[model samples]
Target: MGALKFKFLFAFVLVFIVAIGSANIAEFDEVWQQRAAMAEKDAEAAYDPYPEQSRNRAVEGRNSTRRSLRGYKGACVATNPIDRCWRCRRDWARNRKRLADCVLGFGRKTTGGKYGRYYVVTDPSDNDMLNPKPGTLRHAVIQPEPLWIIFKGPMVIKLNEELIMTSHKTIDGRGAQVHITGGAGFTLQFVSNIIIHGIYIHDIQQGSGGLIRDSVDHYGFRTMSDGDGISLFGATNVWLDHLSMRNCHDGLIDAIQGSTAITISNCHFTKHNEVMLFGASDSYPKDSIMQITVAFNHFGQGLVQRMPRCRYGFVHVVNNDYTHWLMYAIGGSQHPTIISQGNRFIAPHNLFAKEVTKRDYAPMSVWKNWLWRSENDLMMNGAFFVKSGDPKRMAEFTAKDVITAKPGSYVPRLTRFSGALHCTINKPC
Candidate 1:
């Protein structure tokens, strides 16, 4: 009887232990299933249907946050305002404000508003007039008429003809578009404080021997012809903004003959021999100290070689994006003191395969020009193609210093207009 009681007690204890273990296992399985279901629900919530207003609000919140971090104002942010509205104007205002603070801090040094007088040129809307007279130098002034001559409509001016510019006058564009056709070019001789804005200039072929074509097949380097989209001569305090030029023999923009305090911004240059030409003849020693700023521009496509040639001067090439080029995206002069910063150069293959050999004339100084190679870009050309005496400094460039834009990308705010004071003209011709 004692042995039977002990066996029964042992069996009862073993059964009780198994029951407790089974209950614990069942509880763990239930908890795990609950957690999995909660995770799935959260994922589903991520795709919840929201109204357009809510979506916009979320985006605006994100943009606001980013703007706050960068100390930037999103006042001019819009979608494609150039066609319907003056978007570039708005951006120009914002940029001017940002630069004004910096310029004031630098003590507002007076750089002789040599191109001071401003003028407006237009064609006659009526058939009564054909050959419109160019404005005179004496009439161009900062006071009274303020050198604002309104051209009637889009027309072409003949070459070798003089358009005398007086001091402190800026040639502001009317709402109407102006096109300068034929092989003629405007010569700005001894002008100061001039601003040419919102113009489309094309097809002004340079005179004989003005452009040289290379046998090589580079995009921007090989020039079939020579005529700059715009040329500046002996001009100071000049601003060339919101302009587009394509398919010229020489350069899209050319600055020669001692042009100083020049700013070329928010412009597009495509399908040209050279995107920009700084110095043709450094005959004038003062031209050697060319102080120009080329910024916020898009240059690409159909360009074969030598995007820019900077000879004998100080230049700040910043915040411009180059899509594709054949060779030597930018070539510097043997002269030093050139700052090439905040620019993006994109070439998948050996875009700049032909290295520029250092000329014996002078020691060229090139620092911080960014070069990019895409995964799809293969180097079929030889590796040692680039010929620069100072190749050691070239390897130090990184993506952080370059301003690169993706292909087919554009910033609409770049061309928007923000504020303008409209003044009425009482006297008419």
Candidate 2:
């Protein structure tokens, strides 16, 4: 009789577990569909049909000699629409808050600290992890109120531990040369509306875990960091722009565990393997909501692979200059939708690594149906992109071609000022 009871209980528990699993799968599917729709909408909204037409018309009116005499410095040259929005202004310092309104792509809604007062970082020291000084960058980011953080001068801050950030903050390193190196990197975990711009983040090391203040009201024990230059764990509405990154212990930038609505733009990356990873785990179906836009960045020398590698997400890689790569440029697994539009891919001299895209843990029969498209991409040095999926599906994913881009041949001119700019007080950035 006892044996019979045990068998009946086992059957009941199995049914209950199956029911819960089915319900969770249904929830995951629902969230994925919603986020995918939102991503498509954001991508479409960020498109500009003709950014260079006006400039080209003006150049045509002027003679070559006159144009040459004008020079590159006198003219405020803004290539892409994102740069044109703010980089053309001479009084950018006077109106520093205007940059908060200029974010494009999936992170367009990120108005980081736009409504808040400026918090200038006068100190570059990170002596205290739990109780940071008032004039330090750590203090500026952990405040409960919004703040537009900026540096007073050129400085290098080697953090003693992982610098945790709060919501509604902007670290604008426009006028000053700011470098965060030889230590741990920034951590944006479960935060939103953050903009990290114009900072050099490289040579990072893993942090030994201890008590760290993450916010104004929260101080908690933490674990050792992965040593990424910028690590995003469950973060949203974040934009990283005009930064130079390389030679980190782990990835240059990593967004994982349900992080979404991010844009990495106008940055320069070099001398790094596993440059960027969008989704970390294949089993994390919650990452289906992850969406990112990589635009106008220069992938320079001594790079290996994953610029970036994605999984279970939508990534729009548009108008970037890939000058060098030892391994494959872009890679993925678990059926991520990657739209490569008008990007310049110059493969290395190595004949074995000529393919721009790499797929893992999937056979041709399965991965051939994944939505990966290359539209107007310029491939050089015998480089090629192995595209898959149906044309109709590609059209649908692109929202009827609302997200248009310039041809990849224009990449050099578009990405001319890719990295952090040296802006004078009253000059255009």
**Each model's Cα RMSD:** 32.0, 8.1
lDDT of 2 by residue, 250-300 (tens): 999999877877889989998999999999888887777787889889999
Report the C-alpha lDDT of model 1 over 87-147, residue by residue, as the tens digit.
3244532222222111100011212232223244433221111122334222232233334
Angstrom error at residue 302, model 1: 2.4
Which residue pairs in candidate 2 collide?
none
Model 2: residue 13 alpha-carbon error in angstroms: 26
Give the CA lDDT, 0 to 100, for residue 80 in model 1: 22
Q: What is the lDDT of residue 92 in candidate 2?
A: 94
Task: Note the Cα lDDT for every prediction shown.
Answer: 0.41, 0.80
TM for every model, in the order presented, reads 0.51, 0.83
Among these predicted structures, which one has the highest TM-score? 2
